[model samples]
Structure formats: structure tokens, C-alpha cells
Target: MAGRIVVGVDGSEPSLKALTWAAGQAALTGDALQTVIGWEYPASWAALMPGVPPEFDPERLAKQILDEAIDQALTPAQAAAVTRTVVGGNAPQALLDAAEGATLLVVGDRGRSGFTAAVLGSVSLHVTQHAPCPVVVVRGRTGA
Candidate 1:
């Protein structure tokens, strides 16, 4: 069994599927599962409206989104074996950072993309190319 299995979640259907797959793998291998949600504040807005009040704490928002996504993705029984992490950055970099020393890093085939034809988004491709450990891109029924 591996020591740890890490999965990236972004509250998308494919990401949820990836989380589910990672959870099953963790249970099968009796390894700890780390579910990570990566988020970055929009730089363009901050730059455009420098004087506007900050609407939210980026770290807190990240955690809240991650927690909600995890709750929605995992059942109570399956959630017990999982640990949650919220990172401040884009998906690929955050996943790579969290994958250090991890046995495996799991991610969705695609995420929050409006482009219908874009199968695997840039983040997944980047992570697959650069993650330190083996990376698994979970493809759902959409075949992305």
C-alpha cells in the first residue's frame, strides 16, 4: 500500500469523479488520502480596482470551497479516511507542491472550462508533465 494518495478537487463534476476514484483507491490500498482544492484570487480584478474593499479572505475562501467540495464529493464513511487541504495558487502548481513525496497524485480530466471541445484543461496537462510522483488523470463518462 502506498503511504498517501493526493487528489485535486475544484467542485466540478469531473473533479468530483476524480475524488471518488481517489477515495476508492485509498480505501483499497489502506493509504491515507489527501484532498486538495486549489484557488487563486483574480489578479485582474485586484489590479483594476485597487481601491475596492477586499470582499473575502483568499485563504478562507479557498478552505470553504474545498470543504464544501469534499463534503459533496464524499460520503460520510468515505470521508473518514480523507484529509483536506486548501492551497493558494492555480491547480497545477498547487497539486505539484502537494504531491511532493506522495505516492500518487490524482486529478480530473477537465475542470471549470466553458470550452466544449477542450478535453483536458491546461492544469491537468501541466501537472501530468511536472508532478514529482505518478499522476493519474481521472476521466469520467465524458471521456475527457
Candidate 2:
């Protein structure tokens, strides 16, 4: 059976870079490529405001982000061949779940809004340590 390659995208520059790199790898390997993105409500939303959820739908936002990332990162044919998934809850766990039965899992070193000083973002670190398959953490400084 042909293998699958799962890549995590979070709408960050590094994520876009990872997506592009993963797409090229998928094309070369003839493996199915799937992009997974995770989203969750801030803890404060549950703790401070119990009943009312934010009017902005995080799920929709996640989907939009995935779509935009795909557009920005991949060629038309590559984007058309890719599958997009938006998962709810923690990013690392969501990526790990998606990587099940896949040949490879790829992620960016850091995501959007993370601490700038961190060498590796928590999600990437966790997935690299615990992913079901081999993991690739794409890391580099983006040119201005």
C-alpha cells in the first residue's frame, strides 16, 4: 500500500515552509499528503465565561487557516492533491492522532504566537518525541 505523509500547519511562516517542503517530499515519494491543523478555545474562555462561547468559531478559523496555508505554500496541482483536516483540541495530540498508520509526520519548529526565544515549540517537541511514525521538524529563519 502506498504510504501517507502527514504535515501539521498552523498558518505561521515556518508552517508554510514545512507545508511546501512536505508537499515536495510527498510528490517525490508518491505518498498521500495530508495537512492537519488544530485549534482550541483559550482556557480563560472556559474559566471566566462558562456558558457563552466566543462568537468567532474557532473551527471555521482553523479551516480558513488551513486553506490559506495550502494556497500560500503549494502549487495548484499539489494543493489539489492534498487533504486538509482541522482538528479540535491540543495540536501535538491531534497531529499524533492524524499520523497514525502514516509513514511520516512533519511539523514546523515553532507555531504562531509562541515564545520567540523557544528553540522548539511545545507541539513540535511533543510530536517528535511521541509521534506514531518518524517525525520531521522543519527549522530555519525565514528571509525578510
Candidate 3:
């Protein structure tokens, strides 16, 4: 492959849309696709709250979400052409890090954060503002 296309995927509808778009671009440009899922411990956990431990494994959950998204957004051939990357850190920073040496960075307008419609999500905005390579934020189509 000539270059790598880095795509941030978090299992959201818009993210899947971005993934689909990125996959097509990767194929057209003869670039390898790297699907990245960045996660961090719950904010509340930082407080060392006296509560029961989390029942789910965040690492496993992240991998499942990424794999399911790949399955849903790409065909078997396309999926085989992709490489999954899992990182433990803030989403925006993780994406920026993954974009290093990449030909392009792609992400959704909003992730699972459930931000309001008034503005683009913070991660997308940050990547657009500071990513080393060109960044594409895929938002929902007006009438699609």
C-alpha cells in the first residue's frame, strides 16, 4: 500500500458511515485501512469511588464494538483489507496519534457521547483543527 488511512470507529451510526466512506477511499487510493477504537476508564473511576467494580471488560467490549462495526460496514473482502487498532486514552488524542504518518484521517461528526445538534462533536472538531493529515468528518446526510 502507498499510505495508510486512519479511521476512528466507535460503533455509532455516523461512525459506521465514516468507516464505509473511509474503506471506499482506501480501496480507491490503494491505501491500507486502520480502524481505531480508543477508550478510557470511566471518568467516575478516577475519583476512586467506593462502589462495586465494573461488571464488563472494557478491552473486550472495545474489541467487540470494533469488530461488529467492521462486519456491519464492510464486505468480507473489504474487512480483510483492514487492520484494527485499539488504544487506551482520550478519543481525540488517540485519533491524532493514529493519524501520524497517515495519508488521511476520517471520523464521524459525533460519537457515542450524544452531543447536541448545535455543534460538531469535540473529537471531530479537534481532529479537524489539529490532525497532521487531512481529516474528513462524516455527518448524516440531509435526506438520506
Q: All candidates' TM-scores?
A: 0.86, 0.91, 0.90
Query: After superposing candidate 3, which stretches have Cα over 4 Å from the reference?
Result: 46-55, 141-144
Candidates in order: C-alpha RMSD to true structure: 2.4, 2.5, 2.3
- In angstroms, give how far residue 5 of model 1 lies from its true place: 0.5
Clashing pairs in 1: none
Q: In candidate 3, what are the lDDT values of residues 48-81, reduced to their tens digit?
A: 6556466756778899999999999999999988
- What's the best-to-worst order under TM-score? 2, 3, 1
Given candidate 1, what's the lDDT at residue 57?
A: 78
> How far out, in Å, is residue 88 in model 2?
1.1
lDDT of each: 0.83, 0.90, 0.90
Model 2 has a clash total of: 0
Q: Show where candidate 1 strays beyond 4 Å.
A: 47-55
For residues 1-144, what per-residue lDDT tens digits would candidate 2 score against the true structure? Answer: 689999999999889989988998998899999999999878787776677655868899899999999999998999999999999988988999999999999999899976778888888989988988999989847444
lDDT of 1 by residue, 1-144 (tens): 468999998877778899999998988888789998888767697686688666657778777767877888889888766888888788788899999999999998888762556667787888999999999999856533
